[model samples]
Target: MSEQLMVVGEITAPHGVKGWVRVRPETDLDQLAGIKRCRLFWPDNKERLFEVEQVRPHRQIWLLKLKDVSSRDEAEALRGALWMIRRDEAPPLPEGHYYVPDLVGLEVVTVQGESVGEVSEVLFGPANDVFVVRRSGLPDTLIPAVREVVKEIALNQGKIIIDPLPGLLD
Candidate 1:
Protein backbone atom coordinates (compact mmCIF):
# COMPACT_ATOMS: atom_id res chain seq x y z
CA MET A 1 0.00 0.00 0.00
CA SER A 2 1.09 3.57 -0.61
CA GLU A 3 2.43 5.41 2.40
CA GLN A 4 -0.01 7.91 3.86
CA LEU A 5 1.96 10.35 5.95
CA MET A 6 0.11 12.05 8.76
CA VAL A 7 1.62 14.80 10.84
CA VAL A 8 1.72 13.62 14.44
CA GLY A 9 3.79 16.29 16.08
CA GLU A 10 6.14 19.23 15.58
CA ILE A 11 9.68 19.79 16.81
CA THR A 12 9.08 22.69 19.15
CA ALA A 13 12.66 23.16 20.30
CA PRO A 14 15.93 21.46 21.13
CA HIS A 15 16.32 19.88 24.53
CA GLY A 16 19.21 19.87 26.97
CA VAL A 17 22.90 19.39 26.21
CA LYS A 18 21.98 16.13 24.49
CA GLY A 19 20.34 15.81 21.09
CA TRP A 20 16.96 15.01 22.61
CA VAL A 21 14.17 17.24 21.26
CA ARG A 22 11.01 18.69 22.71
CA VAL A 23 7.94 17.74 20.73
CA ARG A 24 4.47 19.25 20.71
CA PRO A 25 2.15 16.37 20.01
CA GLU A 26 -0.79 16.85 17.66
CA THR A 27 -2.49 13.78 19.04
CA ASP A 28 -3.78 13.43 22.56
CA LEU A 29 -1.23 12.68 25.27
CA ASP A 30 -2.61 9.19 25.69
CA GLN A 31 -2.38 8.50 21.98
CA LEU A 32 1.22 9.71 21.89
CA ALA A 33 2.37 7.00 24.26
CA GLY A 34 2.22 4.37 21.54
CA ILE A 35 4.35 6.17 18.97
CA LYS A 36 7.61 4.27 18.65
CA ARG A 37 8.80 5.47 15.24
CA CYS A 38 8.20 8.41 12.99
CA ARG A 39 9.26 10.00 9.71
CA LEU A 40 10.67 13.48 9.78
CA PHE A 41 10.07 15.77 6.84
CA TRP A 42 12.05 18.95 6.48
CA PRO A 43 10.61 22.17 5.15
CA ASP A 44 12.71 21.62 2.04
CA ASN A 45 10.95 18.29 1.36
CA LYS A 46 13.79 16.08 2.51
CA GLU A 47 12.67 13.09 4.54
CA ARG A 48 14.50 11.17 7.23
CA LEU A 49 13.09 8.08 8.82
CA PHE A 50 13.69 7.73 12.57
CA GLU A 51 13.12 5.15 15.24
CA VAL A 52 12.07 6.37 18.63
CA GLU A 53 14.97 5.79 20.94
CA GLN A 54 13.22 7.16 23.99
CA VAL A 55 9.99 8.90 24.89
CA ARG A 56 9.19 10.46 28.24
CA PRO A 57 6.65 12.89 29.56
CA HIS A 58 8.03 16.24 30.65
CA ARG A 59 5.32 18.57 31.87
CA GLN A 60 3.57 19.89 28.76
CA ILE A 61 6.15 18.61 26.30
CA TRP A 62 7.43 15.23 25.22
CA LEU A 63 11.16 14.68 25.41
CA LEU A 64 12.24 12.47 22.55
CA LYS A 65 15.47 10.84 21.47
CA LEU A 66 15.75 9.66 17.90
CA LYS A 67 18.01 6.79 16.96
CA ASP A 68 20.43 8.98 15.00
CA VAL A 69 20.36 12.22 16.93
CA SER A 70 22.76 12.17 19.87
CA SER A 71 23.60 15.80 20.62
CA ARG A 72 21.83 19.03 21.30
CA ASP A 73 23.14 20.64 18.12
CA GLU A 74 21.78 17.84 15.98
CA ALA A 75 18.37 18.12 17.59
CA GLU A 76 18.36 21.89 17.32
CA ALA A 77 18.85 21.59 13.58
CA LEU A 78 15.57 19.71 13.41
CA ARG A 79 13.58 22.42 15.14
CA GLY A 80 10.43 23.22 13.18
CA ALA A 81 10.55 19.96 11.28
CA LEU A 82 7.19 18.22 11.21
CA TRP A 83 7.13 14.66 12.53
CA MET A 84 4.96 12.41 10.40
CA ILE A 85 4.01 8.75 10.36
CA ARG A 86 2.20 6.48 7.99
CA ARG A 87 -1.55 6.71 8.50
CA ASP A 88 -1.75 3.00 9.06
CA GLU A 89 0.68 3.42 11.91
CA ALA A 90 -2.01 5.09 13.93
CA PRO A 91 -4.50 3.15 15.99
CA PRO A 92 -8.16 2.88 15.06
CA LEU A 93 -10.60 5.55 16.14
CA PRO A 94 -13.89 5.02 17.92
CA GLU A 95 -17.18 5.24 16.12
CA GLY A 96 -18.55 8.74 15.39
CA HIS A 97 -15.05 10.11 15.59
CA TYR A 98 -13.34 11.59 12.56
CA TYR A 99 -9.98 13.10 11.85
CA VAL A 100 -9.71 16.75 10.89
CA PRO A 101 -8.73 15.97 7.33
CA ASP A 102 -11.93 13.98 6.85
CA LEU A 103 -13.94 17.15 7.31
CA VAL A 104 -12.17 19.13 4.64
CA GLY A 105 -13.99 19.51 1.30
CA LEU A 106 -17.28 18.27 2.72
CA GLU A 107 -20.26 20.18 1.37
CA VAL A 108 -22.09 22.32 3.94
CA VAL A 109 -25.83 22.66 3.49
CA THR A 110 -28.60 24.10 5.57
CA VAL A 111 -31.42 21.97 6.91
CA GLN A 112 -33.68 23.63 4.36
CA GLY A 113 -31.45 22.32 1.54
CA GLU A 114 -29.76 25.66 0.79
CA SER A 115 -26.08 25.48 0.02
CA VAL A 116 -24.36 27.70 2.54
CA GLY A 117 -20.78 26.82 1.81
CA GLU A 118 -18.17 24.13 2.03
CA VAL A 119 -15.87 23.16 4.85
CA SER A 120 -12.66 25.00 4.14
CA GLU A 121 -10.80 24.08 7.30
CA VAL A 122 -11.18 22.81 10.83
CA LEU A 123 -9.85 25.16 13.48
CA PHE A 124 -8.80 23.88 16.88
CA GLY A 125 -10.00 25.87 19.85
CA PRO A 126 -9.51 25.70 23.59
CA ALA A 127 -13.03 24.46 24.21
CA ASN A 128 -14.00 22.94 20.88
CA ASP A 129 -13.22 22.89 17.18
CA VAL A 130 -14.66 25.37 14.71
CA PHE A 131 -15.50 24.64 11.12
CA VAL A 132 -14.47 27.35 8.70
CA VAL A 133 -16.98 27.57 5.90
CA ARG A 134 -16.38 29.48 2.68
CA ARG A 135 -19.47 30.59 0.82
CA SER A 136 -19.86 31.91 -2.72
CA GLY A 137 -21.19 35.41 -1.95
CA LEU A 138 -20.53 35.86 1.73
CA PRO A 139 -17.50 36.14 3.91
CA ASP A 140 -16.27 33.02 5.60
CA THR A 141 -18.35 31.85 8.54
CA LEU A 142 -17.22 30.11 11.70
CA ILE A 143 -19.49 27.33 12.89
CA PRO A 144 -19.05 25.90 16.32
CA ALA A 145 -18.16 22.23 16.17
CA VAL A 146 -21.24 21.13 18.01
CA ARG A 147 -23.62 18.33 17.13
CA GLU A 148 -26.58 20.72 17.39
CA VAL A 149 -25.30 23.08 14.72
CA VAL A 150 -23.59 20.36 12.78
CA LYS A 151 -26.80 18.38 12.50
CA GLU A 152 -25.28 15.57 10.54
CA ILE A 153 -21.89 14.66 9.12
CA ALA A 154 -21.59 12.08 6.36
CA LEU A 155 -17.97 11.40 5.63
CA ASN A 156 -18.62 8.77 2.97
CA GLN A 157 -20.92 11.07 1.02
CA GLY A 158 -18.58 14.03 1.56
CA LYS A 159 -21.30 16.23 2.93
CA ILE A 160 -22.48 17.81 6.18
CA ILE A 161 -25.94 19.14 6.86
CA ILE A 162 -26.22 21.80 9.56
CA ASP A 163 -29.17 23.34 11.31
CA PRO A 164 -27.38 26.59 11.95
CA LEU A 165 -28.68 28.54 14.89
CA PRO A 166 -30.32 31.95 14.47
CA GLY A 167 -28.01 34.71 13.20
CA LEU A 168 -25.43 32.10 12.31
CA LEU A 169 -25.40 33.33 8.74
CA ASP A 170 -25.23 36.97 9.69
Candidate 2:
Protein backbone atom coordinates (compact mmCIF):
# COMPACT_ATOMS: atom_id res chain seq x y z
CA MET A 1 0.00 0.00 0.00
CA SER A 2 1.69 3.22 -1.16
CA GLU A 3 -0.42 5.68 0.81
CA GLN A 4 -2.76 5.89 -2.12
CA LEU A 5 -5.73 8.22 -2.01
CA MET A 6 -9.03 6.82 -3.27
CA VAL A 7 -10.69 8.92 -5.94
CA VAL A 8 -14.31 9.20 -4.86
CA GLY A 9 -15.76 11.78 -7.24
CA GLU A 10 -15.13 14.81 -9.44
CA ILE A 11 -16.35 18.40 -9.35
CA THR A 12 -17.98 18.77 -12.72
CA ALA A 13 -19.45 22.26 -12.57
CA PRO A 14 -20.80 25.03 -10.34
CA HIS A 15 -24.42 24.59 -9.34
CA GLY A 16 -26.67 27.64 -9.27
CA VAL A 17 -25.37 30.81 -7.55
CA LYS A 18 -24.39 29.07 -4.33
CA GLY A 19 -21.00 27.70 -3.50
CA TRP A 20 -22.30 24.25 -4.38
CA VAL A 21 -20.64 22.21 -7.08
CA ARG A 22 -22.05 19.30 -9.03
CA VAL A 23 -20.13 16.12 -8.39
CA ARG A 24 -20.22 12.84 -10.21
CA PRO A 25 -19.33 10.36 -7.51
CA GLU A 26 -17.74 7.02 -8.07
CA THR A 27 -19.27 5.59 -4.93
CA ASP A 28 -22.83 4.49 -4.44
CA LEU A 29 -25.34 7.32 -4.45
CA ASP A 30 -27.03 6.03 -1.32
CA GLN A 31 -23.77 6.25 0.57
CA LEU A 32 -22.92 9.76 -0.57
CA ALA A 33 -24.45 11.51 2.42
CA GLY A 34 -22.15 9.68 4.80
CA ILE A 35 -19.13 11.33 3.26
CA LYS A 36 -18.39 14.40 5.37
CA ARG A 37 -14.86 15.12 4.25
CA CYS A 38 -12.50 14.47 1.39
CA ARG A 39 -9.21 15.44 -0.19
CA LEU A 40 -9.33 17.62 -3.29
CA PHE A 41 -6.67 17.26 -5.95
CA TRP A 42 -6.10 20.21 -8.22
CA PRO A 43 -4.73 20.09 -11.73
CA ASP A 44 -1.70 22.08 -10.52
CA ASN A 45 -0.77 19.10 -8.27
CA LYS A 46 -1.90 20.82 -5.10
CA GLU A 47 -4.00 18.84 -2.63
CA ARG A 48 -5.98 19.79 0.46
CA LEU A 49 -8.53 18.33 2.84
CA PHE A 50 -12.03 19.81 2.76
CA GLU A 51 -14.86 19.33 5.21
CA VAL A 52 -18.15 18.73 3.49
CA GLU A 53 -20.72 21.31 4.42
CA GLN A 54 -23.63 19.77 2.58
CA VAL A 55 -24.30 17.14 -0.05
CA ARG A 56 -27.56 16.26 -1.80
CA PRO A 57 -28.87 14.60 -4.90
CA HIS A 58 -29.41 16.76 -7.95
CA ARG A 59 -31.00 14.70 -10.70
CA GLN A 60 -28.41 12.20 -11.86
CA ILE A 61 -25.55 14.00 -10.14
CA TRP A 62 -25.01 15.25 -6.62
CA LEU A 63 -24.66 18.80 -5.40
CA LEU A 64 -21.89 19.40 -2.88
CA LYS A 65 -21.12 22.35 -0.67
CA LEU A 66 -17.77 22.35 1.00
CA LYS A 67 -16.92 24.33 4.06
CA ASP A 68 -15.23 27.67 3.25
CA VAL A 69 -16.39 27.57 -0.37
CA SER A 70 -19.20 30.13 -0.23
CA SER A 71 -19.53 31.59 -3.67
CA ARG A 72 -20.41 30.43 -7.15
CA ASP A 73 -17.00 31.59 -8.34
CA GLU A 74 -15.38 29.63 -5.55
CA ALA A 75 -17.15 26.50 -6.66
CA GLU A 76 -16.40 27.24 -10.28
CA ALA A 77 -12.75 27.47 -9.44
CA LEU A 78 -12.91 23.88 -8.23
CA ARG A 79 -14.41 22.62 -11.46
CA GLY A 80 -12.66 19.51 -12.72
CA ALA A 81 -11.04 18.86 -9.35
CA LEU A 82 -10.79 15.21 -8.43
CA TRP A 83 -12.47 14.46 -5.14
CA MET A 84 -10.50 11.92 -3.19
CA ILE A 85 -10.78 10.23 0.17
CA ARG A 86 -8.29 8.49 2.37
CA ARG A 87 -8.01 4.77 1.77
CA ASP A 88 -9.42 4.09 5.22
CA GLU A 89 -12.48 6.21 4.55
CA ALA A 90 -13.39 4.26 1.44
CA PRO A 91 -15.66 1.26 1.70
CA PRO A 92 -14.07 -2.13 1.59
CA LEU A 93 -13.82 -3.78 -1.81
CA PRO A 94 -14.68 -7.38 -2.51
CA GLU A 95 -12.04 -10.03 -2.91
CA GLY A 96 -10.03 -10.05 -6.18
CA HIS A 97 -10.83 -6.40 -6.78
CA TYR A 98 -8.17 -3.72 -6.19
CA TYR A 99 -8.07 0.01 -6.26
CA VAL A 100 -6.44 1.76 -9.19
CA PRO A 101 -3.64 3.31 -7.14
CA ASP A 102 -2.77 -0.03 -5.62
CA LEU A 103 -2.45 -1.66 -9.03
CA VAL A 104 -0.42 1.15 -10.56
CA GLY A 105 3.36 0.96 -9.99
CA LEU A 106 3.27 -2.78 -9.44
CA GLU A 107 5.79 -4.78 -11.42
CA VAL A 108 4.24 -6.77 -14.27
CA VAL A 109 5.51 -10.12 -15.49
CA THR A 110 4.36 -13.12 -17.43
CA VAL A 111 3.73 -16.42 -15.72
CA GLN A 112 6.61 -17.90 -17.72
CA GLY A 113 9.01 -15.58 -15.87
CA GLU A 114 9.26 -13.03 -18.67
CA SER A 115 9.54 -9.45 -17.55
CA VAL A 116 7.10 -7.05 -19.15
CA GLY A 117 7.37 -3.81 -17.18
CA GLU A 118 5.54 -1.82 -14.53
CA VAL A 119 1.89 -0.84 -14.48
CA SER A 120 1.89 2.87 -15.13
CA GLU A 121 -1.87 3.30 -15.48
CA VAL A 122 -5.19 1.52 -15.76
CA LEU A 123 -7.90 2.24 -18.32
CA PHE A 124 -11.36 1.48 -17.00
CA GLY A 125 -13.96 0.10 -19.38
CA PRO A 126 -17.55 -0.94 -19.01
CA ALA A 127 -16.74 -4.61 -19.14
CA ASN A 128 -13.18 -4.79 -17.89
CA ASP A 129 -10.16 -2.64 -17.09
CA VAL A 130 -6.95 -2.59 -19.10
CA PHE A 131 -3.55 -2.40 -17.48
CA VAL A 132 -1.08 -0.13 -19.21
CA VAL A 133 2.36 -1.69 -18.89
CA ARG A 134 5.19 0.75 -19.50
CA ARG A 135 8.19 -1.00 -20.93
CA SER A 136 11.72 0.36 -21.09
CA GLY A 137 11.78 1.15 -24.83
CA LEU A 138 8.76 -0.62 -26.19
CA PRO A 139 5.33 0.88 -26.42
CA ASP A 140 3.02 0.47 -23.46
CA THR A 141 1.32 -2.93 -23.38
CA LEU A 142 -2.41 -3.17 -22.92
CA ILE A 143 -3.26 -6.13 -20.75
CA PRO A 144 -6.92 -6.89 -20.48
CA ALA A 145 -8.26 -7.62 -17.02
CA VAL A 146 -9.62 -11.07 -17.68
CA ARG A 147 -9.19 -14.20 -15.60
CA GLU A 148 -7.63 -16.06 -18.52
CA VAL A 149 -5.10 -13.28 -19.04
CA VAL A 150 -4.44 -11.97 -15.54
CA LYS A 151 -3.27 -15.05 -13.69
CA GLU A 152 -2.70 -13.59 -10.26
CA ILE A 153 -2.36 -10.24 -8.53
CA ALA A 154 -0.11 -10.38 -5.51
CA LEU A 155 -0.48 -6.96 -4.01
CA ASN A 156 1.47 -8.04 -0.95
CA GLN A 157 4.31 -9.10 -3.24
CA GLY A 158 4.06 -5.87 -5.27
CA LYS A 159 3.67 -7.66 -8.57
CA ILE A 160 1.05 -8.98 -10.96
CA ILE A 161 1.53 -12.32 -12.66
CA ILE A 162 -0.11 -12.54 -16.04
CA ASP A 163 -0.60 -15.38 -18.48
CA PRO A 164 -0.57 -13.64 -21.80
CA LEU A 165 -3.03 -14.74 -24.46
CA PRO A 166 -1.54 -15.86 -27.76
CA GLY A 167 -0.23 -12.85 -29.68
CA LEU A 168 -1.54 -10.60 -26.94
CA LEU A 169 1.89 -9.32 -26.07
CA ASP A 170 3.25 -9.13 -29.63
Candidate 3:
Protein backbone atom coordinates (compact mmCIF):
# COMPACT_ATOMS: atom_id res chain seq x y z
CA MET A 1 0.00 0.00 0.00
CA SER A 2 1.11 3.55 -0.63
CA GLU A 3 2.03 5.62 2.40
CA GLN A 4 -1.06 7.00 4.03
CA LEU A 5 -1.45 10.71 3.43
CA MET A 6 -3.68 13.39 4.94
CA VAL A 7 -7.24 13.08 3.72
CA VAL A 8 -8.30 16.35 2.12
CA GLY A 9 -11.71 15.28 0.94
CA GLU A 10 -14.06 12.42 0.11
CA ILE A 11 -16.05 11.51 -2.96
CA THR A 12 -19.52 11.96 -1.56
CA ALA A 13 -21.45 10.94 -4.66
CA PRO A 14 -21.65 11.14 -8.41
CA HIS A 15 -22.91 14.54 -9.42
CA GLY A 16 -23.97 13.93 -13.00
CA VAL A 17 -24.10 11.37 -15.78
CA LYS A 18 -21.05 12.92 -17.42
CA GLY A 19 -18.72 12.00 -14.50
CA TRP A 20 -18.65 15.03 -12.24
CA VAL A 21 -18.51 14.17 -8.54
CA ARG A 22 -19.49 16.07 -5.42
CA VAL A 23 -16.59 16.31 -3.04
CA ARG A 24 -16.98 17.14 0.61
CA PRO A 25 -13.71 18.78 1.46
CA GLU A 26 -12.27 18.33 4.92
CA THR A 27 -9.68 20.97 4.30
CA ASP A 28 -10.29 24.65 3.80
CA LEU A 29 -11.20 25.86 0.32
CA ASP A 30 -7.99 27.81 0.06
CA GLN A 31 -5.97 24.77 1.04
CA LEU A 32 -7.84 22.62 -1.45
CA ALA A 33 -6.87 25.01 -4.20
CA GLY A 34 -3.24 24.23 -3.62
CA ILE A 35 -3.72 20.53 -4.17
CA LYS A 36 -3.11 19.99 -7.86
CA ARG A 37 -3.04 16.23 -7.54
CA CYS A 38 -4.54 13.68 -5.18
CA ARG A 39 -4.18 10.03 -4.28
CA LEU A 40 -7.50 8.30 -3.94
CA PHE A 41 -7.85 5.08 -1.98
CA TRP A 42 -10.74 2.69 -1.90
CA PRO A 43 -11.79 0.54 1.03
CA ASP A 44 -10.10 -2.52 -0.43
CA ASN A 45 -6.78 -0.70 -0.51
CA LYS A 46 -6.95 -0.04 -4.22
CA GLU A 47 -5.43 3.30 -5.09
CA ARG A 48 -5.01 5.67 -8.00
CA LEU A 49 -3.18 8.94 -8.28
CA PHE A 50 -4.98 11.49 -10.39
CA GLU A 51 -4.20 14.97 -11.50
CA VAL A 52 -6.96 17.43 -10.69
CA GLU A 53 -8.59 18.49 -13.94
CA GLN A 54 -10.99 21.04 -12.54
CA VAL A 55 -12.34 22.24 -9.21
CA ARG A 56 -15.11 24.68 -8.47
CA PRO A 57 -17.17 25.61 -5.46
CA HIS A 58 -20.76 24.39 -5.74
CA ARG A 59 -22.88 25.65 -2.89
CA GLN A 60 -21.20 24.18 0.22
CA ILE A 61 -19.60 21.29 -1.64
CA TRP A 62 -16.82 21.18 -4.17
CA LEU A 63 -17.27 19.91 -7.68
CA LEU A 64 -14.25 18.01 -8.90
CA LYS A 65 -13.11 16.29 -12.06
CA LEU A 66 -10.20 13.94 -12.38
CA LYS A 67 -8.04 13.77 -15.46
CA ASP A 68 -8.92 10.14 -16.16
CA VAL A 69 -12.46 9.76 -14.88
CA SER A 70 -14.93 10.45 -17.67
CA SER A 71 -18.24 8.80 -16.89
CA ARG A 72 -20.84 8.61 -14.18
CA ASP A 73 -20.00 4.95 -13.61
CA GLU A 74 -16.37 5.84 -13.06
CA ALA A 75 -17.27 8.50 -10.54
CA GLU A 76 -19.83 6.32 -8.79
CA ALA A 77 -17.21 3.63 -8.36
CA LEU A 78 -15.13 6.08 -6.39
CA ARG A 79 -17.88 7.06 -3.99
CA GLY A 80 -16.85 6.80 -0.34
CA ALA A 81 -13.19 6.65 -1.32
CA LEU A 82 -10.98 9.08 0.57
CA TRP A 83 -9.07 11.66 -1.48
CA MET A 84 -5.72 12.34 0.08
CA ILE A 85 -2.80 14.56 -0.69
CA ARG A 86 0.67 14.50 0.76
CA ARG A 87 0.92 16.55 3.91
CA ASP A 88 3.79 18.46 2.41
CA GLU A 89 1.63 19.20 -0.60
CA ALA A 90 -0.70 21.37 1.46
CA PRO A 91 -0.26 25.10 1.27
CA PRO A 92 1.57 26.85 4.07
CA LEU A 93 -0.53 28.61 6.68
CA PRO A 94 0.25 31.68 8.72
CA GLU A 95 1.85 31.28 12.13
CA GLY A 96 -0.37 29.93 14.94
CA HIS A 97 -2.64 28.18 12.47
CA TYR A 98 -2.46 24.41 12.31
CA TYR A 99 -4.30 21.60 10.60
CA VAL A 100 -6.39 19.36 12.84
CA PRO A 101 -4.51 16.18 11.96
CA ASP A 102 -1.19 17.83 12.74
CA LEU A 103 -2.36 18.66 16.27
CA VAL A 104 -3.47 15.16 17.19
CA GLY A 105 -1.09 13.06 19.32
CA LEU A 106 0.76 16.10 20.68
CA GLU A 107 1.61 16.12 24.37
CA VAL A 108 -0.41 18.64 26.37
CA VAL A 109 1.09 20.31 29.38
CA THR A 110 0.27 23.14 31.73
CA VAL A 111 2.31 26.30 32.04
CA GLN A 112 3.72 24.86 35.26
CA GLY A 113 5.22 21.99 33.22
CA GLU A 114 2.84 19.38 34.59
CA SER A 115 1.84 16.81 32.01
CA VAL A 116 -1.88 17.17 31.42
CA GLY A 117 -2.52 14.63 28.69
CA GLU A 118 -2.17 13.88 25.03
CA VAL A 119 -4.24 15.46 22.32
CA SER A 120 -6.60 12.79 21.02
CA GLU A 121 -8.79 14.79 18.70
CA VAL A 122 -9.51 18.28 17.38
CA LEU A 123 -13.21 18.96 17.30
CA PHE A 124 -14.74 21.61 15.00
CA GLY A 125 -17.58 23.45 16.63
CA PRO A 126 -19.62 26.54 15.89
CA ALA A 127 -17.10 28.69 17.73
CA ASN A 128 -13.69 27.19 17.10
CA ASP A 129 -11.66 24.03 17.15
CA VAL A 130 -11.62 22.32 20.54
CA PHE A 131 -8.58 20.33 21.49
CA VAL A 132 -9.66 17.10 23.13
CA VAL A 133 -7.15 16.01 25.75
CA ARG A 134 -7.22 12.45 27.01
CA ARG A 135 -5.72 12.36 30.49
CA SER A 136 -4.75 9.33 32.46
CA GLY A 137 -7.35 8.17 34.98
CA LEU A 138 -9.60 11.12 34.26
CA PRO A 139 -12.25 12.24 31.84
CA ASP A 140 -11.22 13.96 28.66
CA THR A 141 -11.04 17.74 28.71
CA LEU A 142 -11.92 20.19 25.96
CA ILE A 143 -9.57 23.13 25.59
CA PRO A 144 -10.83 25.96 23.48
CA ALA A 145 -8.62 27.32 20.74
CA VAL A 146 -7.93 30.67 22.27
CA ARG A 147 -4.72 32.57 22.75
CA GLU A 148 -5.42 33.24 26.43
CA VAL A 149 -5.83 29.58 27.37
CA VAL A 150 -3.40 28.01 24.91
CA LYS A 151 -0.14 29.72 25.75
CA GLU A 152 2.00 27.82 23.32
CA ILE A 153 1.67 25.21 20.60
CA ALA A 154 4.91 23.60 19.60
CA LEU A 155 4.06 21.44 16.63
CA ASN A 156 7.70 20.75 15.87
CA GLN A 157 8.19 19.35 19.36
CA GLY A 158 4.73 17.77 19.45
CA LYS A 159 3.79 19.68 22.56
CA ILE A 160 1.21 22.19 23.71
CA ILE A 161 1.11 24.34 26.83
CA ILE A 162 -2.13 25.65 28.23
CA ASP A 163 -3.02 27.90 31.12
CA PRO A 164 -6.53 26.71 31.62
CA LEU A 165 -8.86 28.89 33.63
CA PRO A 166 -10.01 27.73 37.04
CA GLY A 167 -12.80 25.14 36.92
CA LEU A 168 -12.17 24.76 33.18
CA LEU A 169 -10.56 21.41 33.71
CA ASP A 170 -12.86 20.29 36.53
Top TM-score model: 3
- Candidate 2 achieves a global lDDT of 0.85
Q: lDDT (0-100) at residue 139 of candidate 2?
A: 93
Compose the digit string of candidate 1's lDDT tens values, residues 131-158.
8999998899999988889888888788
- What value of lDDT does candidate 3 attain over all alpha carbons? 0.86
Count the clashes in each prediction: 2, 0, 0
Model 2 CA deviation exceeding 4 Å by range? 1-10, 15-35, 43-48, 52-74
Ranking of models by lDDT: 3, 2, 1
CA deviation > 4 Å runs, candidate 1: 24-33, 53-65
The predicted structure with the larger TM-score, 1 or 2, is: 1
After TM-score superposition, the amount by which residue 68's alpha carbon in candidate 2 deviates from its true location, in angstroms, is: 7.2
What is the C-alpha lDDT profile of model 3 across 135-159, one tens digit per residue?
Answer: 9999999999888899999988899
Clashing pairs in 3: none
What do the candidate models score in CA lDDT, each in turn?
A: 0.82, 0.85, 0.86
